[model samples]
Target: MIEVRNLTKRYGPLTVVDDLSFTVQAGQVTGFLGPNGAGKTTTMRMIVGLAAPDRGSVTVSGRRYADIAVPLSEVGALLDAGAVHGGRTAYDHLWALAASNGLPRRRVGEVLARTGMASVAAKRAGGFSLGMRQRLGIAAALLGDPRVLIFDEPVNGLDPEGIRWVRELMRSLAAEGRAVLVSSHLMSEMAQTADHLVVIGRGRLIADTSMSEFMRSAGEGTVHVRAADPGALALRLSAAGAGVREGLESSLVVSGMTAGDVGRIAAYHGLALSELTPQRASLEDAFMELTAGSVDYQGVTS
Candidate 1:
């Protein structure tokens, strides 16, 4: 498991991460979400000991990342896919890392094949496309077969098939009891991949909750009701303190009320309903609603 407590970082006068605390538990995929300039990169850097925190602590398992004798064996990270040396072949690069970390050379080959980079192992990283570079980076991260993994935008340049591969890979990693923390801006993918979420905005913690709970807490969701007598049902629902609006095909959109309550009201008034369905907010809609104030850059609207 990965733990972050009271973590803070600053540059000049601007504080980036402020008193952020969260845990990435074992056997689960925790999504790290934030708008641009929300200090996500800084937090990830601090966790891996690439950047020093001004206050607080980050630990993998029970010890700091730096304290681990074989850091790569305990924690694997892919912060920047393009940070590799372009002059080196993919195989050479993995071999170098394994050598430096005292890992077996065969592990390099295993990871290359695991990440679907076996065919391009001899190719220089400089000649690889962005997607290929991402795969190579993933291969490096898995070389150590670490118990904990951190990935920042792992699917950045991947195509649909590659994206699906990553999604499945993350799930499989968590299934094996590895703590996986991934940060990404793709809401649709995140919705499908993450079991839990840690959302941040402007260097502070906004939300940390299970994906299902977060969606439920986003709003009560609107209820769609189509009754035999639309006008009378709307009147009764409005009088019961529910916000009712006209919807397509003479249906009523209702808020501030549950489906059960709507049904009860309809039944109480002897109103026959043709259709009653609840429409919950999508992940993208909920994210935008919650992070509205935290966006650092907003485009001008005409």
Candidate 2:
């Protein structure tokens, strides 16, 4: 497991991470989410000892990353896929990292094949595409088969197939009882990939919850109803304290009430209903609402 308790980081006058705390448990994928410049990368760096936190602590299995004798075997991370030497081959890059960590050289070929880079293992790092580079980075992270893994934007430039591949790979890693923390801007993908979420904005924690609970706490979902007497039903629902608004095709969007309540009200009035659907807020909707005020920059249009 990975534990970050009140983790804080600063640079001169600017604070990049502020009192952040979350746990990435084994056997699950915890998605680290935020807007641009939300300090996600900085937090990941702090976890791996790339940057020292000004305060608080981050530990793997109850030990600071620096304290772990064989750090790679305890925690693996892919912060920047392009941070490797451009002149080296994919195979050479992993070899160097393994050597530095005192890991076996045989793991090199295993990870190359595991990340589907076996065919291009000899290709120079500078010549690889972004997706291929991502694969190589992941291969390096898996070099030690660590129990904790951190991946920052692993699918940044991947195609649909590549994205699916990464999704499955992360799932499999979690299934193998490893703590997986992934950071991404893709809401749709995160919805399907992550079991838990740590959302932040403007260097502060916004929310830390499971996917289902987050959606449920986003307030009551609006109910869409298509009734035989649309006009009469709207008035009755409005009178019953439901916020009613016109919807497409002679339907009413009723808020501040549940679908069961709406259906019962329509039935009491003897109004036949064709559709009574509850529209829950999606992940993107909830994220936008939660982080609306914390965006660093906003484009304005007149």
Candidate 3:
């Protein structure tokens, strides 16, 4: 398991990650989510000892990363594809990292095949595309077969097929009882890939819960009812303490009332009900609501 307790980081006069505490358990993929510049990269770096936390601690098993004799075997990470040498072939790069960690050379072939980079194993990294470079980075991360793995936006520039490949790869890694933590700004993708989530804003954790639980907490369930006289329906629902809002042309969005309740109300009022459907907010909707105020960057039209 990967455990972080009150983890904090700072640079000069700025604090990026602050008093963050969370646990990434084995046998599942936990997504690390936040807005741009929310310190996700910094936190991942601290996890692998690439950058030191100014406060608190991050540990693999029960030991600090620095204290783990063979840190690679305990935790492996892919922070950025560009971290590798541009002039070196994928094979050569993996060989160097393995040599530095005293890992066997055969594992190089294993990870290359696992990440589907075997075809391009001999190609120089500088000549590879972004997706191929991501695969190469993942291959290097798997070189140690660590119990815990971290990937920062592993599918940033991939096509649908490549994204699916990465998703399946994460699942397979967790199936073997390894803890997996993947960071991404893509909510739709993360919803499909992660079983749990760690949502953060302004360098602080907003939520640390299972995907189902977080959705349940932030998601609202409403009933949509359409009637010939929505004004009458609205008045009745309002009198019944159900919040009602205009929806579409002749429909009312009713809150605090179930479909059955709406049906009963319509029958009691002798109203002609055309449609009544229940709507529950999705993960994507809930994420937008929760982080609406915390978003740091957005694409704007000039």
Candidate 4:
């Protein structure tokens, strides 16, 4: 598990990360979400010791990343897939990382195969496409078979198939009992991949919650109701304290009432119904509403 407590970072007059606290638990995928320039990358860097925090602390499995005797064996991070030596082959990159961590040479080949890059092991990284580079970066991160993994925008340039592969890989890693934290701009993918979310805005923690809870609280769901006497049903529903609006030809969209309550009222009024469905808000909707004010750069039309 990863623990970030009151982690803060500043550069001159600009504070990138504020007093943020959250945890990435084992056996689940935690999504780190924010608008661009929301200090997400800085926080990840601080977790891996790439950038020292101005205050507070971060730890992996009860020890600071720097204090771990074999950091790679404990925590693996893929912050930048393009931050590799462009001149070297994919195999060489993973090999260098393995050697530096005192891992066996055979482990490099294993990771390459695991990431489906064994066939391109000898290919120069400079010639590889963005998707290929991402594979290589993941291969290097898995070289030590670490129990904790962190990925930043792992599907940035991936095609549809590649994106699906990454989604499955994250699930597989967490199934193997590894703690995984991922940051991505793809809300659709995040909805499918992450069990929990850590949302931040303006360098401060906005929400730390399960995906279900986030959606539930972020939206006031509407009930879709259809009845033989539509106008009558609407009047009855509104009288029951539900806000009703006309929907389609003969349906009513109701808010501030539960499906059960709607049904009970219809039965009480002897109103024959054809449909009664509850529509919950989507994850993307919830995320946008939650971070609406947090976006630093808003593009406006003249």
Predicted structure with the largest TM-score when compared to the true one: 2
Q: Number of the top candidate by lDDT?
A: 1
- Candidate ranking under lDDT, highest first, comes to 1, 2, 4, 3
TM-score of every model? Answer: 0.85, 0.86, 0.85, 0.84
Model-by-model lDDT, in order?
Answer: 0.95, 0.93, 0.89, 0.93
Could you tell me which residue pairs clash in candidate 3?
none
User: Which lDDT value does model 3 have at 30?
Assistant: 99
- By TM-score, the better pick of 1 and 2 is 2
List candidate 3 stretches off by more than 4 Å.
222-277, 298-302
Residues 1-302 of candidate 2 have per-residue lDDT tens digits of: 98999999999999999999989889999999999999999999999999999999999999999999988899999999998899999999999999999999999999999999999988899998999999999999999989999999999878999999999999999999999999998998898999999999978999999988988888877899999889999999999999999999989999999999999999999999999999987788889899998899889999
Which model is ahead, 2 or 3, in terms of lDDT? 2
With candidate 1 superimposed using the best TM-score fit, by how many Å does residue 85's alpha carbon deviate from the native? Answer: 1.0
lDDT of 3 at 240: 87
Candidate 4 lDDT by residue in tens digits, 1-302: 99999999999999999999999999999999999999999999999999999999999999999999888899999999898998999999889999999999999889988889989999899999999999888887788999999999999878899999999999999999999999999999999999999999989999999988887796667899989999999999888899999989778999899999999999999999999999876678788889999998999999
Query: How many clashes in each candidate?
Result: 0, 0, 0, 0
> Which runs of model 1 end up more than 4 angstroms from their true locations?
223-277
lDDT of 2: 0.93
TM-score: the better of candidates 1 and 3: 1
